[model samples]
Target: MKKIENLRTDYKRDQLNESSLASCPIEQFKLWFNEVLDVIIEPTAMVLSTYSQNKGVSSRVVLLKELQQDGFIFYTNYNSLKSEQIKLNPCVSLLFFWPDFQRQIRINGLVQKISHESSVNYFKKRPRKSQISAWASSQSSVIKDRFVLEALFHDFEKKFKNKTISKPPYWGGYKVVPNSIEFWQGRESRMHDRFLYTKHQNNKWIINRLSP
Candidate 1:
């Protein structure tokens, strides 16, 4: 087996230049997102990082459900550890790494729960099994064993049988309104291209290229 430290990839897939970038980060993100639609599996998956004063920081992979003009949105159980941390501190970060394109996008922002009506609208489109699972899973809570979870799923399944399942009270979506967004593209010889878009007080985006 090769030594872990000796294993590395010299990325030369692409280069990101200021002239080729969109003035609005969201537009740029959409451009890149559309380009990868056929290349990456689960292209909408992103790493969500949340911080808690007591627990420090935590990171997990979450699916990006919506990319609106202002922010990115995802749904989860309100009683989960991430949600508890978000309640403690609303600031968070999101990261998307597309290895096939040798690219990465980082977003730092504040999170707030999306409107209940919006959540309900999206929830209604979910598959019935997923809706039932949302109700069955307590999320981030500990249980004795697999049987306990399976039992809970079975119970909810029976309860919601032949009926439309509704979104749980503690389940919803959160939108991340970004203040700063960075796009990185890998280049040859360990040199990479990075562009950062920071929202100014006037609500305009200021783009800057960073040394890489």
Candidate 2:
């Protein structure tokens, strides 16, 4: 096997110059996101990091369900560990990495639960099995085994049989309102391109380029 240290990739596919970047980071994100739609699988997947005094830090991959001008949205069980951490500390970080494009985007933000109506609207759109699973799973809870989960799923399945499943009272969405967002592009010889957009007090974005 080849040595891990010997493995390297020199990115030369693209470059992000100030003149070509949008004044609004969200617009820029939409541009790059649309470009990758044809080339990347699960393009909406992002790494969400949350921290609390008790837990220190935790990270997990979560699907990005919606993106608005103000924030990004994702849903989960309210009783989950991440939710508990968020309740204690609302600040969080999000990361989106697309190796195929040698690109990454990092966002730092504050999270808040989105409106119950909005959560229910999104929840109802999910596939029936997924909706049922959301009702059955007590997220982040320890169980005896896989069979226990399977049993719960089957029980919920029958309970909701021939009926419209309602969104669980404890399952909903959170919005991460970003304060800063950084876009990173890998380049040759490790001279990468990095640009950060910070929200100013006036609610305008201040952009700055940093050394790779």
Candidate 3:
């Protein structure tokens, strides 16, 4: 068996504190996200992880498409592995690592399907080709080859030619309502700064310092 190793870079960009963080985690996420968005070089992307009760575990790196008070939202086919996992177990974790900023945020939360209205609104904003592709493809399904997928996209494009592309019945968004949020800042050696915000019984957020 191959030996696994711990490979890490030292982090010393900034420090996080309960006093400086926004009372709401989402608000805090927005502030960090905007900073990442502004940096054209080495921009950070979102990493969404899903857990399945039946199929074991799986994860994918998806962009942070949108965010709201309810939770973090992303789109995918209803029959995808992540979707299946969510259907079986609505709990999942999201990790965002901004290497340029030398910071990482880990979120644990319950997942829920978003409303149809919101899905339609986002669908309309996508490029015309993407709209058709969403309608044509059964994401995560076994397929023959690249040509087959391209054919599907092309067929759907032709089918919806002149007409407005509508949201697919099987495709939509999901929100992850965070029960806990952990912020990590790299420091000297392995002594990293860890700030965790856990949800209280009264639905309030309580900040704690976790050993790193």
Cα error, residue 166 of model 2, in Å, equals: 0.4
lDDT of 2 by residue, 1-212 (tens): 99999998999999999999999899989989999988999999999999999988999999999999999999999999999999999999999999999999999999999999999999989999999999779999999999999999999999999999999999999999999999999999999999999999999999999999
Q: Per model, state how many residue pairs clash.
A: 0, 0, 1
Per-candidate TM-score against the hidden true structure: 0.99, 0.99, 0.91
Ranking by lDDT: 1, 2, 3
| RMSD of each candidate relative to the true structure | 0.7, 0.6, 2.8
lDDT of 3 by residue, 184-209 (tens): 87877878888888989898998888
What would the TM-score be for candidate 3 when compared with the true structure?
Answer: 0.91
For model 1, residues 73-143, the per-residue Cα lDDT tens digits are 99999999999999999999999999999999999999999999999999999988899899989999999
Residue 187's lDDT within candidate 1 is 94
Candidate 3 displacement at residue 147 in angstroms? 1.1
